[model samples]
Target: MASVKTTTLPGGIINRPGSTIDYKTGTWRVKRPVVNLDKCIGCLICWIYCPEPAIIKRDDGKIDFDYDYCKGCGICSLECPTKAIRIVEE
Candidate 1:
């Protein structure tokens, strides 16, 4: 298993409500997920499997990732049925 890097608040504790909004976690990524729209069949598997709530349904009936909140965990790539998502080194 791979280790995950994360942000810790000062004193390793969060004091504010909704503190997650203050963090842009994508900076911690060593690898990033990329979407291949050509292979994407509009399946919602990636959205469903993404633990970060990063994958979102778009108005065009396609899906997009909110990279600011994404930790590059690669679950979306693994779950994509058509192999539409790939993980690449940053």
Candidate 2:
């Protein structure tokens, strides 16, 4: 097996009436992965397998991910043990 890596920087103009936040990753908004913190156990499994390393653990022990860098591949949602994540078509 081989590994594929991707990196992207966020770009956009300030609030100017409907200015689009340009995310270079082509799959932007392709799928929406919602994390259910209510069910999340802070296991960090989703964080480890996230190909883009988008998941970030806050100092308060909450988890969040950067959507701008997410490819929406659904791997994280699938790998979550507690069913803490789900992917919806966008």
Candidate 3:
């Protein structure tokens, strides 16, 4: 995938708000986050720390990642008490 040029991003009040959902920001990442479900305790820490709504709570009470907009920020991995989320090369 080609990099999204900074020039195309929102400028001084010139772009629409909440337009992030229109773009898959994860594509810009060099690394991605992988979740180890077995180690996950369903504590919701990852969900709480995620800047994006990438960590989703399932019907079963467990969580899953939404790679579509994750952006590989690693905040979830850092906040997970059980260290269930790991970062890997894309």
Candidate 4:
């Protein structure tokens, strides 16, 4: 299995979880989750629960975030049940 799960920018959304992480860089090593509009229902749970509030709703009903501030806490993914979020390694 992979040691690291996903790598997000500053502010991003994580709707689901499917991986782990390796934090040996001595930094926060925070990563954001990528959300899929096709599978998202706009539940907004991830947004409300995000510690950094990185989640944002697009004008077209799509959702996005700024990874620059994201910590990759994985709370959003664990909260999401649809598995629409994928954690990418940086």
Candidate 5:
């Protein structure tokens, strides 16, 4: 039998909030998502679908992108029912 070591606090666990913000991951993005305000229904689907959570929901119910953290994954565009979000080359 082999011995295994474990701890109450696991490694690679995010213990603090907003730690990802310190890293700007969008530097390598070749494409980015753009939101059409006129077509946007403010449904928040994009915000919920974004893997990086780069979508920002404003106080007015509208949404915006945090390009600094957005990796251009296009998950938001695929999830948007209104098709308000579009991916474009950078």
Candidate 6:
């Protein structure tokens, strides 16, 4: 019989918070997202769907991308209802 290892911490517990900010994950991105500001319509659908802190909402009610942390997952482009965001090869 094999002995099972036990953990003092609870399952699905987060030991570290905000750890993603410590690492820049965009270096390996094969595709990048580009935004067409004219077609954006200020919908913010991309910003809401982005998994990373790569979407920036400007004070003027517009949005921009932070490439340093954006992994180019294309989720933003897919979620944009106005087709304002497009994915291009890096």
Evaluate all candidate structures by whole-model CA lDDT and list the values in order: 0.80, 0.73, 0.81, 0.68, 0.84, 0.81
Off by over 4 Å in 1: 1-16
- Best prediction by lDDT: 5
Ordered list by lDDT, greatest first: 5, 3, 6, 1, 2, 4
**In model 6, which regions exceed 4 Å deviation?**
1-19
Better of 2 and 4 by lDDT: 2
Per-residue lDDT over 1-90 for candidate 4, one digit per residue giving the tens place of the 0 to 100 score: 235446864576544563223333214545658887798888877888887666777887657865645677778888877877787666
Q: What TM-score, over all chains together, does every model reach? A: 0.76, 0.66, 0.75, 0.62, 0.76, 0.74
Better candidate number, 3 or 5, judged by TM-score? 5
Candidate 6, after superposition: displacement of residue 61 in Å?
1.0
Per-residue lDDT of 55 in model 4: 78
After TM-score superposition, what is the CA distance of residue 5 in candidate 5 from its true location, in Å? 31
Residue-by-residue lDDT tens digits, candidate 1, 1-90: 123227657787766677566677777778888888888788788888888888888876678888888899999988888988999987
Supply candidate 2's per-residue lDDT for 70. 78
- Residue 77 deviation, candidate 3, in Å? 0.8
Q: Write the per-residue lDDT of candidate 2 for residues 1-90, one digit (tens) a residue.
A: 012224323563343543233444525558868888898888888889988777888776757878767778887889999998988887
- Model 2 stretches astray by more than 4 angstroms: 1-23, 26-29
Evaluate residue 49 in candidate 5 and report its C-alpha lDDT on the 0 to 100 scale. Answer: 82
Q: List the residue pairs that clash in candidate 6.
A: none
Clashing pairs in 3: none
Q: lDDT tens string, model 6, 1-90?
A: 022224435875647776456567777678999988888887788888888869999787878999988999999998898888999999
By TM-score, how accurate is candidate 3?
A: 0.75
Residue 60 CA displacement from its true place in model 2, Å: 2.8
Worst 10 residues of 5 by lDDT: 1-10
**Model 2 residue pairs with clashes:** none
